[model samples]
Target: MRYYYAEHQAAYRRLGREGMTQWNDLFGESWTFDDFPNRVFLESVLDRLPASGEVLEYGCGTGPAACFLAARGFRVDAIDLIPEAITLARRFAQERGVTVNFSVQDVCAMPVGSKQYDVILDSYCLQSIVTDPDRAAVLAAVRDRLKPNGHYVLSTAMYDSDRVYEDDFRYDATTGICYERSTEPADDAVQLDNTWYLPHRRHLRPKALRAELEANGLQVLSQQGELRGDVICTPTRRG
Candidate 1:
């Protein structure tokens, strides 16, 4: 495996081991909060989708959005890198009596039929891939699996302002990746913070992100926010 892939896998394995003993509120009931902005953004974007669309939530940690969409009558498939997270998501779906196909899979190598989904959502997960090539592979996979004209919803951490990465985090100017790493391994609770588990992250400027997405066949339709960067785009060419 590549170094980045191995590093991410090991870190998440540690996270799974940690979650066995304690629950991080972020992936637990914290999703139940009514004002969760991601949920709000998702709910507001339903107008762009067809009725009862088939949806795929890539990197769907603990399946909140999957369950939410399933509850709203969409067919949902949610994939996450961590088995523990998938287990928790399945249990959460059962508790809510909502059906979501939760699978333990890596986004870079997704095992799904092409052109099967009407919508694909990546909620701040693409940056976790860290490297440009890996991110491109994921975008290609998403493009291949989306039906023509299907919407691709992306949420990412953007570093466009002077205040963005001024907080002592490490920034790689060559790659446009910004991150902070622990000298030693962080404990389970610490891993609950996405940065703790997947420490190597790519925080892109909006222009760069747009270029990458467009290069992968998506055309930007709408974009919002400098911090919680949300983009709504569609395939520029037939899938």
Candidate 2:
């Protein structure tokens, strides 16, 4: 399967869960793609955000946090590889009466532009990357796009001591990806090094995650929450 094709399917099609379009049930029984807890995750890092400046958010599925930041007076540029997701995000921004720069671009190949941002937002998107190379590339892009004093607000799944892997899904400790390896393989099972498995999520252990970030020239300033939490980062000067 191609990268982000599964997510593209998740955009317009129903996963047969809460409702439609990857949103959660906020009220009673409904799914609004424009509204989700991911925005609340963004809000958790409010104290880290700059007063006013440009912010970059990668893998912004429907641009919930992007729209929220724009509404809060920050110039936002949100990107996701899925074109359909970006289309939906643009529509959602219009509905919210907020202006956000939403584009269909892969964060792994993020451009090195002259413009640097005040903040780079992860918002649980980092764990979805699911591979060492891709994660490294994306983190490098985040550091490159951030200003000297900019913050990298990251939220991702961490494999703590208590986290458990389900029976059906197989967890690759080395890669941190949980694969859907059922009796009947999924139609869209992705092949990595000739192994067919549909990656559900990636959980980075705290120690390794910190090392990876530091290797990519980002130093964690503070962190909060539990298994899935927010981390504030700043660029580390390399001699």
Model 2 misplaced stretches (Cα beyond 4 Å): 1-3, 15-35, 160-168, 182-195
Model 2 agreement with the true structure over 1-239: per-residue lDDT tens digits: 54446655564344233334443432345535545555666776677677768999988877777888899899999998877667767888998899999998988777777888999887668777766677888988888888999999887877766777776567878867787653445654666555566766778777777778889999988766666356788999768
Q: In model 2, what lDDT does residue 95 have?
A: 83
How do the predictions measure up, each by TM-score? 0.78, 0.81
Give me the runs in candidate 1 sitting further than 4 Å from their true place. Answer: 1-37, 160-169, 179-199, 226-228
lDDT (C-alpha) at residue 153 in model 2: 87
Model 1, residue pairs in steric clash: none
* Candidate 1 residue lDDT tens string, 1-239: 43345554554456566653212243454434223447777887998898889999988876777887898899998998777667777877898899999998888776556446899998777777776667878988888888887899888777655745544366766567765554445432123344443246787777888888898899899887746479998988753
Task: Give me the candidate number with maximum lDDT.
Answer: 2
Instruction: Highest TM-score: give the candidate number.
Output: 2
Candidate 1: minimum summed lDDT over ten consecutive residues — where? 20-29
